[model samples]
Target: MWGGDRLDNYVEQLRKERGLNQEEFAKAIRVSRQTVSAIENGKYNPSLDLAFIISDFFGKTIEEIFIYKGGADK
Candidate 1:
């Protein structure tokens, strides 16, 4: 299982704060808008490199943007 729900991010909020739409944000980060949507929706987990890119884009640490909820049911 992917355990996507275990991962959380502030991508959408941050992007909006920066006045960037999904397509614009995706282009800035070299990913498809669909990928950005998935990240925001918690339907997909990004690779470490992409995560680093996103963190850098937001001027935040990876931990500040993406939070791991850990294994299911403790």
Candidate 2:
């Protein structure tokens, strides 16, 4: 297992910037609100496929949306 959360994302910020709440953003990305919440709270590390989906939804690159700190950034 991993030591801690090493992945973080700006999903909440980006969603808010677009004026979309969790539910709306989840709909846009074809995810559940719980999934969006989990990602925003740093409790989940999405698979590569989901990462790409998020990047595509935001018109951003995977690296732009997901930050890999090498270790727990919490």
Candidate 3:
């Protein structure tokens, strides 16, 4: 669990920046569109494996995409 850490991600932004819709981005990461929607809406925190996949697809680190706030940031 992330404890008090809030899951903040820039997936939607990055996806649009790459000209990908949710379905396209989801396909790129091999997940369902619902999963991408959930992550973008902050309703789900991706597992480490999915996180790495997303990060790699965007050529970014997990910290760059999903920002874990409220722990050391506080």
- Compare the candidates by TM-score and give the number of the best one: 1
lDDT minimum window of 10 residues, candidate 1: 1-10
Clashing pairs in 1: none
TM-score of 2: 0.87
lDDT of 2 at 17: 94
How well does candidate 2 score on lDDT at residue 42?
Answer: 86
Judged by whole-model lDDT over C-alpha atoms, candidate 2 comes out at 0.84
Distance (Å) between predicted and true CA of 35, model 2? 0.5
In the range 16-66, model 3's lDDT, one tens digit per residue, is: 999999999998889999989988888888999999999999999999998
Expressed as tens digits, the lDDT of each residue in 1-74 for candidate 2 is 32236777898899899999999989888988998888888878777898899999999999999888885435
Judged by whole-model lDDT over C-alpha atoms, candidate 3 comes out at: 0.87
- Segments of candidate 3 deviating more than 4 angstroms: 1-5, 71-74
Model 3, residue 7: distance off in Å is 1.0
Ranking by lDDT: 1, 3, 2
Q: Pick by lDDT: which candidate is best? A: 1
What are the TM-scores, per candidate, against the unseen true structure?
0.90, 0.87, 0.87
Whichever of 1 and 3 has more lDDT, that candidate is 1
